[model samples]
Target chain A: MSTAPTTEKGRRTRARIVDAAAELFYERGVSATGLGDVIAASGTGKGQLYHFFTDKGDLVSAVIRHQVEGTLAPQRELGLHRLADLQEWARQAVLQHERSPVMRCPLGSLVVELSNRNADAASALEAGFAQWRELMSGWIAQLQRRGEARTDLPADDLADSILAAYQGGLVLARSRGDLRPLETALAMAIEGIGSRRAPAGRHRAHG
Target chain B: MSTAPTTEKGRRTRARIVDAAAELFYERGVSATGLGDVIAASGTGKGQLYHFFTDKGDLVSAVIRHQVEGTLAPQRELGLHRLADLQEWARQAVLQHERSPVMRCPLGSLVVELSNRNADAASALEAGFAQWRELMSGWIAQLQRRGEARTDLPADDLADSILAAYQGGLVLARSRGDLRPLETALAMAIEGIGSRRAPAGRHRAHG
Candidate 1:
């Protein structure tokens, strides 16, 4: 074993393994997947896998990080600037869930599965959630700066509610095998935000 | 042949088994719990359990029904008359989750675990959810009549959102092994509802 695989190739291999693991983990829960499955899906031999990650827990942590970064990149790139366009942002979020109906958010699923079982996994999940919350909070703050969202609710709490509803919508959609709940919940949440600026009498429900 | 155990004592034993199964199912999950575990926890023998329940699935169905009724009865007793007291309602809901930090919602948990695997179990889960939705929708409608909630969002969608958030909060709380997420989510949701009547003015962030 003269020289280890080149750093570039090793990086590529690790990414491959993580991507494969993410897909498998989403389809079947983390508790149900195995190292063999990861290896087979990634098309990397056991030696390469072992070289890259010390154990299954290590691999799962990598997968969680990969998924968090992958999912967050889009929101940061496109959503940050579009905070004022609440309707469009809501539509995009709903579409994202509809696009992957069978596979709900992997970060959420992983958190539920591994939170109690593995401390490492729980930490990884918390990191992912914190990243999401921070991104969302920043977006909300931007909206406030633009006079888009209500300044009444603290930006952070509002951000948290939005995220909570989004996650909740995903769960409802998955359970019902329907996307209407997600659509309705998002629409209502956005409406809740917009209503903050309406006149007292016009503060009617917006279902 | 011995007489079938239909006596009062036999009925009590069967009820105990179902209650124990429901508790274990909620805590450890349906798939992880076994009939033997139920037998041990319920202080019932294998033959007695089989006599009461045809199989594990049968017992699971019974447990689902029992939990559904258990949850529903309290809400029914609380009555829709107090729907206007959103703050107290929200507080009570949050307190319910706080009371049992480790125990998940049995019906919701069952829906997630069994919806993908067993048809009968899925049906049972569906019925429970349907009943729950119905109960909530009824409460919301009553609130509308009492001028508590605006008729803007349909009762069904509003009920669904509340239920969805509750389920999502449970998942979030379980993942963190803490109840703050659940509490925060519920409090924010109630605040959103309360803010419905406010004019374009700043209110303190609830969470």
Candidate 2:
């Protein structure tokens, strides 16, 4: 468990530690990273680290949450409300990937190694993915209501499919050392989601 | 580079080592698994191991090939010629995951950690994925030619998308400890591939 930092300075220090730890964890697997390394990377003293997290698990939980926020920030900023929004989002994903040194999702990379190793970490990842998926499902549902996305399938299923494509596309793109896999995967998924034809007898009242 | 086994016994010993190394690499990880562990697990002497493989990199290369064969065996066995075959293959993939202790693609899980750390392993992985994609593309192309699959996109692009869904779905399923994500991603992808409407003014003459 993590202790809440009451003071503003304390919160900043804790955030700094979490950010450092998240980078180390993402670059190197969680198993390979130690508390000492995190302390050195964060430029924080041992006492400061102990004051915030009780153990590595607690720190990992914090890192997972931090990663979730980072992963969702762009999506929240750009929005996912319309079909065009989704296409633009896909384009942005490819662009962001192109700018990064490695082709991996910040959250999904952590999931690959930590999901089966730690119980707390696994649940934290599950919750993080749920939050991400829920946000997407909301947009998909909105689009479905507006007749801009598929309605035959539940919005959540479509949301999950899109997320899967992103994760898988990243993996393939990294493996092939090319952006086409990621680009093609996301394009295909968004195309499928937007391909819903208007119902045969229930035509839209307006464009 | 791996040496060719001149005799039946040498072939058996080499295969055993590769199988043990693959399992260890998957269950643990490539960075964590050492030569000693592989040797102990394979019940082969250190000298015998070195006789076949020049180093851990050589072993990993062989394991990559072994894993590719194992991964493609199912597709080869079931075939990927028609839309039904593709659907059945997806269903089988889900069923296979249901039977496993962990939700991961054998080849993909390897690609996650090894893609960046080792050049030889990375290239081997690239070749493995290329081979896998080629097989799927061939099947998809056949379907497209028969007018049973989408022709608007290149067959290889469709193959990559489907492969991405499988990989991304596996990660999500493992994170959530549920099969629904994998099932949904694959179902949506296949549905998209088969949704190609006959080209305008080109109707099939046969039923």
Candidate 3:
């Protein structure tokens, strides 16, 4: 709800508030995490928190948007964009899970908690998912155009399937404190892209 | 925590507390809901509540089990079993989404909130997912043996994929308040079962 800060100090303060809010929301859930807690954690006064956010609803939307970017930044740079094999993405997902075995998909966890609870927050969550799914679907489309993926379904459908599997896998993974479900689901999803039929003779053994 | 109810009246009181707690948990969230609210909503005293549940943690596991059965009962009876076409299941799922457009998956919503917060509750959620997956996998295995489904991938993989897609679809669907994501994801999943080869002439000619 607040306008972008013109000063560097103001921007830093705003970012600090969002980060504190996100952590509290993730750890204790939205309704239980109050502005007082956020103020305390961020070490910002009520005047500054209010200057940045119109209210709790406004802050929750900002938090959801913040979490979506945090969750996707690495995948865009480190995992998906430069990888030659989609399976590499799956492998990295497992490794990340091994590193942090208990956190739910940040955006996804927000969706379940806020989807039906707040209208403004729900729309923000929807926008976050759409942005992430668009990035994933763009990759699926590129693979399809190159004939490395299934043609029987629309690229959007294929992309949606993979995203769904991933989100669901995270739910099970976090619930079980195990990464196998995420690993298996992602592996099967990549297989669904038809990577196995990549003109078998074209890429000969290097050795 | 508390001992199992030994009398019919005690069992009913315990069930009432669980049902009321589940409603509050689903409406708000586990952390946001209080035992006092549950006791008030269920018309039970604090002593009665404690007679059945030792604490919030114990009640949460009960709530998850309760939610799981609630989600599966209709599917087990009117959906998924003895269906000549897997598409039927997808269609019904879409219809159910239409009927209940605003609510999150009961078990799944609990998962995003409690998975990492409590180990005992997380195990209960995991057991719930496994029970649902097991039922679906049993059906998939039977279909494979009858030559009505894909034989290339293991039935457990197929089942897990379907479950993951379904869970993910619910997340997306709830986030957007649109049924298309769920519909598309499920349609693609049923197709993954490789159902096109169901006896060329036996079930054909009707079209």
Best by lDDT: 2
TM-score of each: 0.82, 0.90, 0.85
Docking class of 1: acceptable
Alpha-carbon runs more than 4 Å astray in model 1: A1-13, A43-55, A82-84, A101-103, A115-117, A198-207, B1-17, B34-36, B43-59, B115-117, B174-178, B191-207
Give the better candidate number (2 or 3) by TM-score. 2
- Clash pairs of candidate 3? none
Supply the global lDDT for candidate 2: 0.86
Evaluate all candidate structures by whole-model CA lDDT and list the values in order: 0.71, 0.86, 0.77
Q: Weakest 10 consecutive residues, lDDT, candidate 2 chain B?
A: B198-207
lDDT score, candidate 1, position B106:
63
Instruction: Kindly list the per-residue Cα lDDT of model 3 for residues A96-117, writing each as its tens digit.
Output: 6687655577788888876475
Query: Which wins on lDDT, candidate 1 or candidate 2?
Result: 2
Chain A TM-scores, all candidates? Answer: 0.87, 0.91, 0.86
Model 2 agreement with the true structure over B1-207: per-residue lDDT tens digits = 788899999999988899999998878777778899999999999999999999988898888888999998767777667799899999999999888767877788777766476888888899999999999999999998988877878899999999999999998898899999999999988887774543233453321
Clashes per candidate, residues 3 or more apart or on different chains: 0, 0, 0
- Native-contact fraction for each model? 0.29, 0.59, 0.49
DockQ for every model comes to 0.29, 0.50, 0.34
Q: Which ten residues in a row have the lowest lDDT in candidate 2 chain A?
A: A198-207
At residue B184, candidate 3 shows an lDDT of 75
For candidate 2, write residues A70-161 as lDDT tens digits. 98876777766789998888898899988876788878887776647688888889999999999889999999988888777889999998
How many residue pairs in model 2 have overlapping backbones? 0
Regions of candidate 3 where Cα sits further than 4 Å from its true position: A75-84, A115-117, A195-207, B76-85, B195-207
